[model samples]
Target: MSIALPQLKSIKIDKFILSLFSAIIIAFLFPTGAGMLHLKQVTEIGIGFIFFFYGLKLSFTEVAQGLKNYKLHVLIQLSTFVLFPLILLGLKSFLIGLIGETFWIGLFFLAALPSTVSSSVVMVSLAKGNVPSAIFNASISGLIGAFVTPLWIGIIVSQSGGMSLGDVFLKLIIQILLPLVIGLLLNKKLGHIAKKNSSKIALYDKTIIVLIVYASFCTSILAHMFDGISFLNFVFLFSAVFCLFWLVIGIIYFISLKLNLSLADRITATFCGTKKSLVHASAMVNIIFANNVSASLFLLPVMLYHITQIVILAIVANRIGKRTLNEAA
Candidate 1:
């Protein structure tokens, strides 16, 4: 008997999406939990674990071999680290009064972030896209962003009080680079095992992200972070984030078509190129914005963009998968 393939399900409202709202609600209702849990320390350790496992799962050999398609890689990297920021920067004058300066800074930070590792690969696989390329690009994007994000921010923000670029780099080294190096060194023996248990690792990744969201939002709530902002401001912020996501997706699709890429590569480029990493955003904010009262405001746009991209792309990926299956059959 032939083995049957797994059935693909259409996207719908799901618990994962609901959990995002739940995270915000819980944080708002019980701001004290953040302190009781010592979330700051937990988040620090969790951030390290996130990168460590990421390094463990990454195979440098596979990443190197996959880089043969230099054009696709370049397009994706530029879209993520360069073009996205430029677009926001171009619109900065228009956005300041509309969304206020603080939210604008948050939006800028969101654009500067790298493409996500887990969700990008998941979306590509679901769409029956270029899995290897997605994996390679997502993994490498983080490494590039670890340095590039701060450099971009430094040009725009001279200083956040006493926190300087030097301090940011120092924290990056201790928190991100050192742990990543340790994991990479450990990868020689542990890579295969980590790869084998990827599903479990993904669950771990999401759990840590949720914890970070709760902690960050809780702290913001305790400080009455959103009290000053009106409901209209949030509505406008959501709209801006929604527009940004679609605009990037459209650009990636058009560029892939222009370059005459393969279907798989096109899907990979569209999905991976358009993503911004919530993991990096959550981890980096604690270091970069250090002790800034408006830290939660910086996270607002990121959370909105992350949620929007996931929901929209999941539906798009499902449709693509169904069409591909029908074409094959």
Candidate 2:
């Protein structure tokens, strides 16, 4: 099950990452255009469609099958939702002073996010891991996050005069939960279409994410929210993100080993547990912080962590795959 080293080396930077940054640059240059065009309303509609496609593509049978491995599921889910958030919360006192309150909140948001669906499964498969469990954990994590992320963020925002927890939940029901439920309800009929055109759907998802990113930055830039952030602050922010990735990876690996998981399950746990979804981040930020002009500021750590996870996990998965092949041979 070894992937070719050459193929691993060929793993280029994700184009979507480029698009994300480009959206930011474009937002900076033409900050007024998004507001002028009323892109906020457009992106909100796009967010609903994103979740609908998510529900459309999801197969309940596969999820049910994955439920048999309760221990594995529990570990991965806890790592994603509980362990990650707790760690950041524990470090909050130190991090806020070092990275600033806004950036720390961004990091907390990153920690609170769900495991990325596509990349988590892909990395597990790449490393010859328990792909089924990865798929299940990745999918379920998002559903869990839809509620949990709001609550987690609610704790912070509630104190700061942001949206009330009740309001956030209401918005989530309308924008995320309802659309997802509709997509699921129609899954029997339209699921094949979603599966058949997954690539197109993924493209659409990224397109919406780009639009959201652009619009968020446009709002922030117009308000000059980033003006106070110096270059040194960015250096500190990136360093914190890099360190945070490894710290979580190390803890997840240790916990997997302690759990005495099979190698395949360990790979699944490590990979899935460590992932954070930018797609969810984009959509949720819009919904959860709808009125916050500083919404884009919260996305900084998320974008940084997204890049960090992809590069680091690709290399880790490649090494593990190579080792597995060597041992088999």
Candidate 3:
């Protein structure tokens, strides 16, 4: 079989966008109607690989490099795990009343999830930001999510009667934290091999992300995730989130400029600090939403934002990134 073919290892990460598009097309053409059961398991493995490769790809050096950007990292992490959630919490007083229970809960839970690591780095890179530091911020964000996400859920969901805080806390410590710790500790040896085969490692990454997306979509269909909202309502809600993203990135941009930071740093902080991870969000969904209808629906806002951010960031990253680099030249 050594014949003319597209080299898998040579395929750029960006091409995975087509893989995602293909998955979407396949689902639409078939409605997940036949023999898609295997996809669920495959997605599960993908998810596992996603986290595993995440561990593999990350290194002590990258982590040490992140420590130098503590101010930026803290701001991004706090914005993700704190500022945004608090904004949603404050808005809860009025927003929930207008949106109804399901939509409100979806919005609420969405706010509580951690900043995604790789995609944050990806988006930051697209925006011509400090890629390495963004990676650190994102990696730490996942570690933080192991605690922060569950804690937020526990405190927030108490009024909703979702689940016991302590039990969930214990489970998060065991399931989420343990693996990451093992990976980190083993990084010296495994990291080399993992980094060497980053291409294959990346397949694991995409597989996991796709699985999460598919599973969440499946959950949505199974649980009537789209219930009670019209196309108009989805439009409105998505707009609200879009504006929310704008407001966030906009604020970060101004603050960075005001602080007299370099354009590179500003772009880094803006993109890294502004968004949430859908992958981590999905992983933690069951904790927050449980059997709630909003668990599935919550995904819509993030997905919408993810796509929009990528497109806009790509344009901005390329334009400004070039100008900044040119100034140095």
Candidate 4:
């Protein structure tokens, strides 16, 4: 006789998610060891290559095809870069009082991030969404966020920390944008190879992300940055991230319905619009909050939201997939 695991036990968790939290725990326990200057150097180089590989994967033809749905694209992008930030802006005062200014700024930073690339596409595809549009939005959103995220943060975070807007932009250009352009330029030669090895490339991205997380957390713990955060504060931050996520999800659903979007388009909008890029968040934090004591605390909201979205969207996508399968039957 064969037996199946209980449904909850059977649910598959991404290994990378496990790796992410492991990195954090390790950072906390072995903070001194991982906080070496050499690890920092390796992390920077790894970040450049992450964006470089990302650019190599983007196909101009796919982007052109996706442009036909310009209205949908605009809506998703606005929801990503504008609506999310505005929601956080309105809640800033309250959140600051509850969690303090550092965490509040982190929340705002999370809102300003772009839609995730791989996970957004995977969720949309699983939900029987417009795969091409999802790919297009996810790809372009990162480039847009490279510029807009810094600008948004600059308006609030003063140059007092020696992190002027110009300094941030310079780092952005050097670390993220320049490598991306080089990769794009070489895409004709490398794109097919990159596509064929996409899984390997994704592994590289995940590895680098884990390294960055470990480094950030190590730095923060060593600096005693999280000493004041209580268990209640943790609960509040988790709740806040969940609510922010659902707010974007709800608004996107309403807009899709109002526009009479097809089921696929609706799914694409929902997944892409509501997600934030942890890759971009991790890479940007190195530059944006470099050497800052609270750098890891700044990552708290983004990291929590990242895990929350993946778990929630996986279930949602599976349900949508089942419903679509039934309709065909």
Candidate 5:
């Protein structure tokens, strides 16, 4: 006799994405109390733990194996740190007019950030791609971005009389790099516990991210930093973010073909190279632009792009996975 099986339903919306928007909305309606609660200190401590857990879970063996694919690594890193920012720089004169100077800076901040570690690896694995390389690129991208992102932002912030470049680096070393190093040092003893409870850790991370978002928006809302922005401007911003995603995807696909990359490597490169980490963006914004009341403005593109990449890549990854399965059959 044949047996009936349950079919899985596709997820149309991510709960975490909804939570992000909700955080913004809550901040809008109730913009007070974040400061009174000392959320800055809370988020700062949370950011340290987030990176600590990130380092704890990172496997040295996987990183070593991923290093074998030097060409692929170089391609992904260059696309992330160089090509993305250069494209934005080239378009700055035109885009800055449309989005306004402040919002344009936000987009540049998004461009300068690193790949999302969890989603990149998950998508690559889903599409039957180079999982190890995705993990390596995603991890290393964040580390590289800790230095590189600030340099990119420094160019703009320096002009505006924001934090000095030296101060930025000093803060990053204390807040981000130091915690990461400590976690790595303890990895040999505590890595397994981190791996075992990764889901819980991820939930903790997301909670902290939501808290950061809420806190930032609260500050901005109270300051009326968004008063000048209009509905039309938001439409334009979303359109620009969408176009940026596909533009980078197209460029990466073309380059992958020209480089004669394997199907798996192509998938890894495209996915990893196009993604930007909201986690890193949230953490860095607080540290890098700490004194700026309009710091939440910088998160706009990062949040929008985070949603865009997740929704679009989920569909694309599933389609590619099905195609690979059919070909194997």
Candidate 6:
């Protein structure tokens, strides 16, 4: 007898859902093996290379032109590096008693990360906005994140009694800065090569990101990150995060409309200004946590937030993109 299985019905899985699955499986199923410790070192080194490759792909020509659009660039960067962090900090007063220092700190870290590369660009492109601006802003955000995100984490965690300022700077420079600078200096040559092999390079880029996702979850599981986290507390934290992001997106949209920017510029403001990067989030975790429980569990909020943002933004982006395209036609 031949048996047939039902088709998986094109179930739309968001990036966050896939990432959350990876995080949970790593935390609960695998736990920590001897191999996991070694993987951490490999993960850090791999992340550096990831940024290096990022440098390789950047076109100086694009950056030169992107600089001319300084007003837009500054707006995106300020919204990402400044306005967003304040909101996360403001929540700390309310969140500390409710979710404890771990969740609060993790949320703060998520706020501090730069705007994302892939999703930000994709959303902007779909809405028929400034693709070149998205690319320029995302790349500049990553470079600054190599410093700002870690610096933000280091300062916050110190008051909470975890990592040191000097330690964080060292890791940021060596793990992130050095490679990125080398890649930048060599970009003119490397950029052409990268363009020629863009598809192959993306495969490598994805592999590195998957390794980071797996390692972070594995470490969290090994440390029993959920040990003291009650189900109710988790539920509350999730609700808070969902509300926080939607509010920010709405506020950005309203402000852009007030600014009277074109619909395309407004779309760029909403997408590039409101999102954070998973790649940078995972990398910054390496700089913050020194011990097991603190390091592993501290990563939870950002992990969860990544998924939440993706799922929500997917619906919003689709809706906005369609309307914008129809009007243009």
Clashes found in each candidate (C-alpha, N, C closer than 3 A): 0, 0, 2, 0, 0, 1
User: Which runs of model 3 end up more than 4 angstroms from their true locations?
Assistant: 1-48, 122-128, 290-293
Backbone clash pairs in model 5 (N, Cα, C under 3 Å; residues 3+ apart or in different chains), count: 0
Which stretches of model 6 miss by more than 4 angstroms? 1-11, 14-20, 34-37
Cα lDDT for residue 321, model 5? 90
What's the CA RMSD of model 1 in angstroms?
Answer: 4.3
TM-scores for every candidate against the unseen true structure: 0.91, 0.96, 0.82, 0.95, 0.96, 0.88
Runs of candidate 4 with Cα error greater than 4 angstroms are 1-6, 159-162
> Candidate 4 on 144-248: residue-level lDDT in tens?
998999998888786445468888889999999999999899899999999999999988888888888899899899888888889999898888888898988
Query: Which one wins by TM-score: 2 or 3?
Result: 2
lDDT (0-100) at residue 155 of candidate 4?
80
Error of 1 at 157 (Å): 2.1
Q: Report the lDDT tens digits of candidate 2 across residue range 1-329.
A: 97644564577878999999999999999999897988989988999999999999999987787889998999999999999889998999999999899888888889899999989999899999998888889999999999999999999768888678898899999999999999999999999999999999999999999998899999999899988999999999999999988898899889889989999999999899999999999999987888788899899899999899999899899889989989999
- Distance from true position, residue 33, model 6, in Å? 2.9
Put down candidate 3 lDDT per residue, 1-329, tens digits, no spaces: 56765345632355555655565555445545423676545543444445656676677787778687666776778777887788788787676666655666667666777777666777677657788888788777777777887787678777677678887766555545556667767788789998888777656666666655555555556555555567877776777677778877877777777777766677778877776776676556644454454454666676666666666666666667667678879
* Candidate 1 backbone collisions, by pair: none
**In candidate 6, residue 29 scores what lDDT?**
69
Model 3 TM-score is 0.82
RMSD of 3: 6.9
Instruction: Encode model 1's per-residue lDDT on 1-329: one tens digit a residue.
Output: 99956455544566655776788889888888988989889888888888898889879987876778887898899999998999999999988878998899999999999999888988999999988889889999999999999878877877554358898999999999988988899998999999999889877777777777788788777788888899999999999999888889889889989999999999999999999998899889888887776787898899899889988898889889889999999
Q: Candidate 1, which segments miss by more than 4 Å at Cα?
A: 1-9, 159-162
Tell me how candidate 3 scores on lDDT. Answer: 0.67
Error at 107, model 2, angstroms: 1.0
What residue pairs are clashing in model 6? 16-307
Locate the minimum summed-lDDT window of 10 residues in model 1: 4-13
Model 4 TM-score (2 dp): 0.95
lDDT of 5 by residue, 270-323 (tens): 999999999999999998888788899989889999999998998899889988
